[model samples]
Target: MPILPRVALLLAACLAPATLAAAPDRAPQDVSGRVLRATGTTTSGEGIPGIAVSNGIDIVRTDAQGRYRLAAGAGQTVFVVKPPGYRFAEAADGLPAFWRTVPADRTAGAMAIDFTLVAEDRPAVSAPEVLLFTDSQVKSARDIDYYRRDIVEPIIGRHPAALGVTLGDLVDDQVQLYAALNAVTVRLGVPWFHVPGNHDVDPGSTGDAASLATWGATYGPDTYAVEEGDAAFVFLDDVVVRPGGTGYVGGLREDQFRFLGNYLAQLPRERLLVLGMHIPVFDTGGRETFRGADRARLFALLKDRPKVLLLSGHSHVQQHYWHAAKDGWQGAAPLHEYNVGAACGAFWSGAPDAQGIPDATMADGTPNGYAVLSLRSGGGYALAYHPARLAAGTQAFTPAMALHAPRVLRRGAYPAWGVFANVFMGDAGTRVEYRVDGGDWLPMRRVERADPRLLVENVADDVATALRGFDRSPEAVPPTHLWRGALPTDLAVGEHRVEVRAFDRWQGEAVAATTYSLQEAGP
Candidate 1:
């Protein structure tokens, strides 16, 4: 076990309230405020006991009558911590129906919010395919049209995935568009869950309590859980509102950590614990994007659960991270975090195509698209990336890398013209290799730099005389998935095939091929 930081140990001790003590029966608190009687029942109206409910602060359990009362202030959201074997009803656009926001009109007094859960008879899904989309950020009808044409159209009624999940940033600062997003997602014909991103916050809220008011009204609780087959998926609201609604920060509240501890305590260790959120728990750019103490508390809870996967999406970049003991992970195996790419690649910016959709390749050269995760019977998971558009004259599934090199090169000038491969999901440890004319494979060095192709793509709009469709793709940022190597300078004046292959830590390999010709020195 790793040594606990002094602050984490102190926070843990302070967070151990009497409410968490084991008791056969406890009476409701005698606090003065808006009292909410939260009751849980089956679809047939039978009371279901021992369900936990929260108002984002205090956690209370139902009595033998399947009811629990908690205090709720104005703009507070009261949500149920959904139990196993029961499924909450979903909203029209696939948001879980597990929470309710107290109206501001009711300044004082008591109200009753009852939750009805239907018994779910899920099949023994030994291997289930799950759809994952991130950073859709739909803001207008045109954006919706783009999504419908490119994403929804190709995915509906075709995929065999059991369910789908969006890793936050559902809309671009317009909570109202969630309905439109939901309408589009509903056609997928599967249960969908969401996480609250920074952009999803209500700007009018002065504090964190009301930041998710609109989100809760539309997508149920910001924090909840769902169990499918042998996997338990937990969604946490990691975006805390900045004071005065100026911005947001990546941190977990004490109550959220409390909820994780209380909920996970009831679950068996054998279940695969899949944690999903908007901001990543891992560090980014030497910054403490996530609170270290909060992360330590969570790691302490899941230290024994060997099968775990962390998912997040707020940076609009796809990359993988492994957390070992130094990062506070105590498991025998390192934990994996998959920071998925955006569906609205580069915020729907770039050159337009024949269909009027933007190229929108990400800074890392990952095309605007989604991912598919396959879960096996023995708590194993594999992920595959899918691109939105295929290259010219090709119909097969898109490859991960898009090689950036000129189609023709002058002899002896190959040293200046290096081949750069943009491996969409690669990290520093990923193995990248390239070969010329199907010869010996040579290693390509990983480079933490902006994607050269994106730089060139952005230059197209910068140098154009008139504005084009949509907007120009933003300037390229330093990418974590790029590799480069100089080509051989002695090739003959003929066509040469360059083949590149990349292998991720999960044992997934992707390959791409292109041909270029070497020309004579003089004309």
Candidate 2:
């Protein structure tokens, strides 16, 4: 198949899915045009010494004069490693002013890039809350308008935390919409960071080298790191375009690994490490979409860190996976990877509601929304899901979920109707219980399967006389947080209420209810 057709099929099928060794002692490589001179300065124009800067493969620090040189390749990005007690200069839209991209054409010339750092007011900060948005795949003017009115407005419902991140796919293929998306993000009133998704790549490019040129121009470095408080956050570009733009693979380049290794070594052993990327590091349902070697290398690097959280966004569905000895993680406890849900749920499909926002519920029945991650000042962290529509103003206390069950069943029928609930933020340890007609609380089985609610929606759209929505939502994918239980059919005839309550591992709870009727068969 042609590249475009293949891309479309991939989208229809699955929506789909560094470096740096030896910063301290090894001497910087001397290449004629490969070197870049980077200076760290404060807003007052004073030289800020001791700031670490990287070229995605090597790590170096500014000297007493606040100047350092990095050996960089063409199309590489050199970003400042944000130090504690200071922040980076931010644009009006709150994107950190921290990186500069080396031109792709100049494979061997030296360039100068300067970074300005602003001192933090609090001197010390241990706990910080970050807003995480993934796969905002907004396409066309209408999508942009919908995003602003729906996703953006609810996210900044109140003054959010000081920092935020968009894991990728800020705009659907049109890179031109980046500015418009940025305009909405600025409303959140915090510095936001980004990663590159497969959609963000420049398909015109021949290979991975130049595929991110446009993205680099719009979002600074495709790979870089920054510090907020006790946490060190690394944003990486893991979408590698194929040789002829056929498709992209999910893995890290040698340069990114080198950079990551070098950068992590400089941070305190106890500091929290948060790695945000577009594609997850693990294989999903035997898809083998992600590179195992890259994941293994990453595990080796973070094996010593007691606290680590990996955040990925390419998968439209929300899931929580803990990597243990069986999954290549060598840590004492399981490594937590939160496959955050998408902002453009089901690619903005399904029927629109009274608010004119598409019911973009994800294929797994997860409502389209963003996430809030709270990092404790000490070390631990907790994450919660915020639905864009339902919990718009009240998510802090309300847990939201999609409950799927038959509305009516014959009293003599076997208990074959399964009640499926997709708790947007539930994990393996989340306690989910369902009761029929205020009966005893019965535990629901945690099942990894397609959400029945979405399956019905897919069937509805597939056979509809006239299309009733923006687009038909895609086929259901296996959900990570779905719970199921067969409803009791041996009941007296009449209407009965079914209620489900899910308590997340963090003690956050949400309740949902529906009514089912039991009827006696007529002779």
Candidate 3:
């Protein structure tokens, strides 16, 4: 049977029943379209030599011209899944690129569902909403069950558009957990995509070749793109592990880098780019180090782009940094890097909650929380932190203390000095205070513009002195304190004092004081 004639016959047979069931006034329906690479200035790619199409059940590979004719009942949804080494543009809302519809009439001619599979820049469609998850380091089937119940179920309940992306650490080196995790997540009624994290790698395996073979077999690809709505998403394998190595480092191989360069080159410069990886591109604290070479190369590729949002999960803490021209990138707009918190919630090692979720906190002292990012059209996004194990109305911070300046620093002579305080589980709207020596107490600036889970209290002063009384212990949680104002100018060298007091949203206040000494100017 000839291809076109055969398709015509198949269409007729499939729509005959639908035509009879519908009112004469109603149109008989079916859809047909060619899948092609999205090429230069074109919405569709020219028919490629070979490709496949499926109507969510029946599957057909495209012919030499990248065209596939599939039979569908009226109103049935049809979509094309890109083969290995190929990708579609990300949708506006960060979804896999797919088009759907209900078939009209079979004889109405095949509905042209042309696919433009470009070798380079792909179109990103906009989705209504997307869910982002990071660090599902499930070490055992039990862990997998926990993730499914605690994290996956809640997200699916929301019925988000499409599925979600796991930022990495999908497994804890068990390798077998991949299947269990997928089995649970795939039931969310949407497709789930993943990136590779350090924990996902096999420490016993060496080189990209061996590890990637295992990874690709379990996960679709090491790197790929999908368009949901109008946004483009690039998932990269940043977790580079050496065979026989227990610890992993962040690096992108030459091939991956080349692929990214090619992919980015073809994309519309104005479109939004959401790059997800296992490790962060930038590190804030001195405690957690960054892969300088890896980051530098990645940044170099991104330097030309105007709107790029980097999403990473390795830090296991929630942090947001906006960089315009840091570390030698010439990006037109500032790049926003969001470090999503771990799903294991401090490696599932912290205090267990009522549901048995562990209290996972990163080493740098940031609380464990996932991030919700809304990628908007025209290159912008809003990020919010959702703390794990906490209900919507939970208060994260409590302020403590009030300060009186002059009474503490009366004998000291100096220009200005500062005070420091702390907050216990600080949240939005907590307040603090500062004062000058023997002066009236005044409200101090809140470090965080909005509510924050933690509060940092500091004071400004001149005369230095050691305030007596309160015992300070390194192991003890710092007292949330408020500071009394500025110190006096010019005084005999001696001991002076400063104090900090903090106020919690729920609790009252507490004070902590520190003293410093002033010395005469050296000759």
Q: Would you estimate the TM-scores of all the predictions?
A: 0.83, 0.84, 0.56
Top candidate when judged by TM-score against the true structure:
2
lDDT of 2 by residue, 1-523 (tens): 1011122222222211111233233233322111122233434555554566677776666543455666666666777777655666776546777777666676434466677776655534456778899999988889988888877876565844758899988878888888888888888777788999998987577699878767878788888887765677899988878787688778999878888887776666777899999998878767766787888888999998998999999989888889988878999899999999998988888888888788898888788888988877756787888878763442222446877778789998988887788888887888999998898999999997888877887888888999869787878887778898788888889998888899877647778887789998899
**C-alpha RMSD values across all candidates:** 6.8, 9.8, 15.2
When summed lDDT is taken over every stretch of 10 residues in candidate 2, the lowest stretch is: 1-10
Give stretches of model 1 more than 4 Å off.
Answer: 1-88, 92-94, 100-122, 325-331, 394-397, 505-507
Q: Give the TM-score comparing model 2 with the true structure, all chains together.
A: 0.84
Put down candidate 3 lDDT per residue, 234-324, tens digits, no spaces.
7888876655654556777776777577556545677677898888876545533457776778888888777788888876555556664
List clash counts for every candidate, in order.
0, 13, 107
* Runs of candidate 2 exceeding 4 Å displacement: 1-42, 63-76, 92-94, 102-112, 122-126, 391-398, 489-493
C-alpha lDDT of candidate 1 relative to the true structure: 0.74
Least accurate 10 contiguous residues by lDDT in model 3: 453-462
